[model samples]
Target chain A: MTDLTAAGRGVRRRGPRTRWGRLRERGYPYALLSPPALLVLGLIAYPVVLVVEMSLRDGRAMNISAIGQEPWSISNYVDVLTDGDTYHSLWITALYTVISTFLSLLIGLGTALLLSRDMPARRLLRTLILVPWAVPGVVASVVFLFMLDGSYGVVNWILRSVGLTEHGPQWYFDPSTALAAVIAPTVWKGFPFFTLILLAALQAIPDELYEAARVDGASAAARFRYITWPAIRGTTVLGIILTGLWTFHTFDLIYPLTGGGPDGATETWAIRIYTEAFSFFHPGSASALGILSVVLALVVVASVFPIMRKQFF
Target chain B: MNLDRRQFLHRAGLGTLAVAGAGALGACGGGDTSSDGTMTLDFPTWQGDEAGVKTWWRQAIASFQQTHPKVTIKLQQVPFATYTDTLTSRFSAGKAPDIVHLPTTTFGSFAAQGWLANLDDRLKGTDILGNWTKVQKTMMWDGHNVGLLVLGYAPVLYYNEKLLKDAGVAVPTTFPELIAAAAKLTSGGVYGYGATTTSHPGTYSEATWMVYGAGGGWSAGEKLRFTDPAVVKAMDDYRTLARYSPKGVPSEQKRTLFFDGKIAMMIEGPFVYAGLDKAAASVKSHVKLAKAPFVQQPGYPSNSIHVSTQASKKKADMAWEFIKSLTTPQTQASYAQLYGVPSPRRGAVTQAMIDKRPELGLFQSVTDSAVDATPDNKDIVTNFSEVQKLIMDACVRLQTSSTPTATVMADLQNKVNGAIK
Candidate 1:
């Protein structure tokens, strides 16, 4: 009989085949993705687990031997919660994140709207707007430090020339201004990210909406409020959440500029974590503080996520 | 259908596990020791970043290698700002180098942590102990020798003589006079007095000199003495002088300002001499050195060398040998002559060396009364940097706001007490 005999019928219907073939057929996509998943577990998840485990132990500079050797307890978390400075730092971090994120989004949205229009040197301007974001955080901090220096900064020179005051304010040294000084650079560096994202979102908005709003006798503000705002709400919320998380953990920007100084006025939770671990050599406490910081950041992101989901998905 | 999906998921999960298992196995490779019966002793120091200082170190290392032919001394250069962080990370990873260039402020903490090898038994009846000053002896932790003094220098007041002369002001010999001179000298863009008032560790060191000069310190016999009347007075005096200085200037900026004639006076160590020598002719011509005006003899902040616990026993001995070699009179003298810094070894500053740089003589003269600024309480003292930050924060408040002195001092006292407790 031929291979296509009635009983055989096209190689006997191929039924499950070999076990290895079945496995490949079922798991090919997951096999292709396993390397990255493994990397994420190794690098990110492993360290996170270590940090959380460390946060549960009693550790300090004097008792390095006791680290992870002692019984695990919530004593570190208890101490962190009871400490007044911890709350102060947490408050500072929250204020910093909120103000910086708000200012960044506002400035980014304004710039995005401006640049989205038909303007002179539009492409060149769009490219140049990214310079701040492209600049390293430390470099941006140093640049702002020189500009706002009390003695011979260009900012001071400009203020003096304009007769703003007799002596320029100590932007970095005064408690009242230190946070603002650090925030200025942080916002400057951060807004560009917002601008790029929001600009894309604004461009995605169809031109017909604006034309329709204009035909209905809407003013610029009215059009922005009705058409543009609705179109970009989801992107704006996402941008703020992303930027807020980053600004909440902004150590490099603040450390180089004010070092969270002028009596710890700028000492946010992130700075506290650094000082605890590096300066005090107490990784346990630092880890505890770090965990708290992450939880707070996650809470902020979670609260914003649902709104984003509802607006978009 | 559900059974097939479950099997597929189980296999995919196994795929992830297999990848992770392979990675863990790959990273589990062992650390191998050197073959051919040669031992490598790694020595990490911040001085290697300095061109001149690095030259001196390379010479020292070469000489050390010549004597210890079987041991190779590897020099690891780290930046000063991140040196502590780097050292701690190395220690945590169990890969610390054999020799560590320890800062005085951190020696006690490292020793307490048992990261450093005790040199007391190792160096018994040795001349290294006799060579160090009383201040250097404080490097011992719990009566065990933890660090050997490597380089020592007392901070002194560096001034622009031209600016003082033009202002018709004499060199201030007392704290009040210094403040008055600063006020007089602070006309135009030039500040009368300059010290780093930022949160840099050097800021704490410089400010503490003023406190020690005022007969105040962080502790007296294990008691928290930060709120002493003397400390308060010193803080007020600093605040006054700070008014005449540009606010929020860093250490390097202060040095540059002094060199450029924008700062009439500043507090700095012997390192300032080198910086002055590098300045333009006008700035260099205007430079002057004076003993730091203090009621008590101010402590000389010094750096020490320690053998790491992570080193093997033989390598530790070699590391100790290398540290001892650094403290020799000959090496100390050579270092002083080349780098213009004072040596911790007594009598290491030769007459010829002093004649070469007069500032060396001034720094040497002040060494006799140099005290350790570290608090006597070992428990709280390990957190010296935190204390320094607290004091610095209070100083900032005193300068930036019209806070009552008593209120500020009380707050500082509370903060310090809380930290130590």
Candidate 2:
């Protein structure tokens, strides 16, 4: 029987006759991996630590010299949590992130499934679908803006002509529609990436498994449930994580569209941090806010990763 | 703004990414200084038409450099939207140019921050400084007497000539006449009047006119008493103006309706006249510029107080000489003829100039009355946006919802006050 300690220590030993001996001979691989491991640690970890350190300090505009001197305080977090003006923005951002991520994944996976089936002219359709990703977010948002314009937008014009809407759909001016409109471009621009990834994952599954399932009298739905889903589940979860992070950090789409205005309906923390730091010149506060947002994002990622691993992998 | 360990570094989020990503759409290729002692003159415009502004600056520079053989000029045009990020990054990285055009609103703050070369000491005896009008006071910061205000626009009410004629409403003067005109023009879905919201740079020019005319001007020391009886009354008076406007008329909306002749009137500065010449020349004949309509107040000016928006025009080596040339009596007349826009100077105005440009009187009178927006230390550009937002919000609430005047005014005051601090 093999002892557990060596495995825990990740130790490999070379001996003549067994599998352990061969694996032990290849132990130098980890040494080669050390550089990247350290690079990620230095790049991702050091900044994270610095930011956390910053979040603990009080910040001010004009007195940039005070950044290092101010003692650690819970005041920033307290103020954010207690401030009535920002609370609604925070709530809206959270709801927006989750809903947009979920919808993006669902639509992405659906498109992936459909495209994977080898329909006629699938390549052309895929090209058309993926084109939105090529345009910069600001440009994409701007184009959509013109398309949804109240008076002369093609979509609104069609709707008005068809008697579906008399005036126009208040996509940006109205509060309820504003949040959704901002989220629309994110899902549109991002869905193609997720679709391609999921499709690749789907394609990687062996054709033999489907044939075997059919031979066993399994229904198409059952075969999909048994084989296709388990195969692509890992990729889907990774896609969701990436999509969620992107949604959480998205600024340009929301900023130009609503400007966190029309009654502050779209004022996400990102918009708040930007306006504070640049517009107001409150660098310390902006950095501190940035750190807080990053920390929250880390916690969100950390929490989600484990859940995804257990449920999907 | 402190983020805890987990949230501080998730730049994968677009918001965090935006910290470094705000202005990457810059046009490459910085202009090179040439042998005519060609110095790179950085020109910033609030909008595009790189070629047009560059041509204007190049011509101006070429003319100025002719007198100074050693001074050659090159123009580097930077779009206004990306100017702050581009110049700021380049400057902090030790790549600042010899001369650059700056808006008057930014002169105080930029000078206070030590970004500009002090011209105050140099301008004292120079013909350039001697020729500068009182309107140039708008560009002077407290400590740094650096820079000069060149291009200027005096704010006023702009009406669509066709719209007013169609509605049979004569141009207004008193508060009652204006309201009646707006009401008559506001029959159905059509709005009668519009002003750019605070989010826009144009809002700063408009709001100062409104508030200064209403018996007050903004300063941190004097906490905005927008809710004070006179201020509140001013706001309520504006609410009446709002009935003739769309629920929220952004700058784009204001520009479109006025150009399309959909809206009857807008609060605008002299820039509209420039736009009329170039972009809207066909419709230009249908637009009329007028003094701000009068407001009723016990102790305030009856006419809406207007102010000039100024910028420094660049000329190499003889920076002072270029400024002097621009402010010269003859040059001012030439400029008036070229653009048919207002001149903001104290010197003699020729009959020939007035014959070419109709509003020379208004421009001349307002030059004496132009409010100096130069702040004590920092750029009003920084604070003006916030002021615009707060006042815009108040106006929106006043117009759309039945939000109480006291509540909105107090809210705006608090936000603006907090920002300046």
Candidate 3:
């Protein structure tokens, strides 16, 4: 990852050096590139390969050095797939990932539209939207949990006050709604990134496109569908991909809120991996599961990549 | 930031390390932790208590330095939050703490991973485990001593005397009496009962107390008979208490309601006593640290349950020495004096703790009868997470609508049993 970032930095450092004509300009490229490369190789590549190796191997994490004595088995992968619980958790995770991503994008797009438009206090609104990210996941979970509290939350208060609800919602406690409670915070913490990315893309679009639509006498909705969306669809795909990745590994929101509870109503695969590996100390199995998650994520990216790439135009 | 060829190379290399190793380096304190003499200990405690713990350790280590002084210990307390993730990275990197604090439930897996030091020789030679209970003995994993009771035994209830007083009640002797007291103390706004049910100490703290208190024994039931009536009764009682809870009974959040005077009564382990005293001056005056009330059954005596602090066996010798010294009457008494925690050792919870904090008298009686939260089984504790999830699910369903409580209860029981097998 740093390699990619460093590649970007190399251009910045060298391009400016030649323009400025400094003595060390020639060396700047190597100077800028070498440190990060060597460090990444030493620190990242070594450990990651070790992890990838362990993922393929059949032993537990703590017993890594005991490789020869311990039997290497394919059972870990078998366990990840055949374990009734794993299958359940994967489905739950997939459901969580899909629902949370969709909801977050919708919420984020709405907010982006509102904030990117000529609204009074747009500065404050944009800043406020970003505040959820600033709130720690656990804290955000607590606050959201409190707000939608079945017995004592503010959401119920507002709802009942307006006669929308007689009592507050039992967000996490109710299985029917518990999954939603976990997803809400993901949308909250993460919508801002989506908004920022999409809005930035919107801003970068040439204003003349909208003007051209107006000159062609297109309806406001038509112009939005034609010019506004087509221009920013690429950024939206990227934003959703990023958010999807974030939600895929999301543990805190689900953990604190529901703990994947109500008899597995909200137990995402991440929570399952935690309970199995960390809580249960099933590392070999857990690592195998972890590898599965990475594969699942890659499959998602690979599936989405072609669509996103084509949309880039 | 101009760099000569070599310097630029070095800087670039370091930068790549910073990025490529973000998770690893971030997992470590900052960057490379391969320093020859320097060691990083991943001490996981409660999430928000890192700073206070660090500060306390700095003083404690400084004092310990008065002894041999040659060794430098960097006591890094991972933030109470993110503790699991922080440790997972360390474990993955093979960079776990030289010393660690393992919870009883988590010890099974950690030991299975060979994350724990075999403290067998350490415990066999030392008198530290003397004050420890045989019931707590089940916490022993793979027949090797993984961790020991370092700080808390378990938390019981700390009630607001003023709130209980205004409600015109003494701490109840039985579960029914306890319920009445809590119910009366509870208004529409003020919770009758307070519990720290959050995952860390509160979940274990109160869950252990309640399950044991209800006399739903943790020993294996007849083969495959996991859910007994007692277990159901215990779950029912917990669900009842959850109804009267302040702030929806988060494992850790109810302390706020208790401290804020919104809760009439709440159960906490010894861990929060010091912090509570700081929050409420009236609590010091009127805060009643009592054992959890017994579950009421006809012709049955009120049974108060014992709560254990999460245990650890990370620094085998040092941890045991600390536990042994702490449980020693003198050390326990000294610690009780320094921090308001009662010495968990029955003998060590002397008359002095009661004299200094008279509220401890209630705890003393409770402590005498306090028992272990059973099944210190690795499978059980690992499954405890599943249990909590199942119970919480039932809790959600029961609270959501007027569903048949039995359906919810049965579903939960089945889920727990399924996880265990």
Task: Give candidates' CA RMSD values in order.
Answer: 4.8, 10.1, 9.2
Question: Which candidate achieves the best DockQ against the true structure?
Answer: 1
- For model 1, residues A1-313, the per-residue Cα lDDT tens digits are 4655865765556645788987877887997788799989999998899889889977563234446685688888988889999999988998899999999998998899899999999999999999999999899988999899987889988999999977888889888888888889989998989999999999999999888888899999899888888888888887977898888889989988877887889999999998888777777889999998888778867887887788764
Superposed by TM-score, candidate 1 places the C-alpha of residue B123 at a distance from the truth, in angstroms, of: 1.3
- Per candidate, the number of residue pairs that clash is 1, 28, 24
- In the range B47-99, model 2's lDDT, one tens digit per residue, is 32532233444556677778766665445556665655564444433455555
Q: Model 3, residue B262: what's the lDDT?
A: 76
Candidate 2 Cα deviation (angstroms), residue A5: 31
Q: What is the DockQ of candidate 3?
A: 0.25
Q: Name the 10 consecutive residues with the lowest summed lDDT in model 3 chain A.
A: A61-70
Best by lDDT: 1
Candidate 2 deviant stretches above 4 angstroms: A1-89, A205-227, B1-56, B127-131, B187-190, B219-221, B246-249, B278-282, B296-325, B366-382, B395-400
TM-score (0 to 1) of chain B for each candidate: 0.90, 0.75, 0.75
lDDT of 3 by residue, B1-421 (tens): 6779779767867986888788775666543233453322233454224323334445455554444243344555555445655665666556665446544444444555556555667668766667754434544656656565444354466788887777788887667777778878888577888754333334444544666677665445333223567766765676677667743456555776677777888766555666664565655667666565655210111111111112233333344443343345565555455555544455666775677777556544544555555553455554554454455445555544566655666665576666666
Query: Between which residue pairs do clashes occur in model 1?
Result: B213-B295
| The best candidate in terms of TM-score | 1
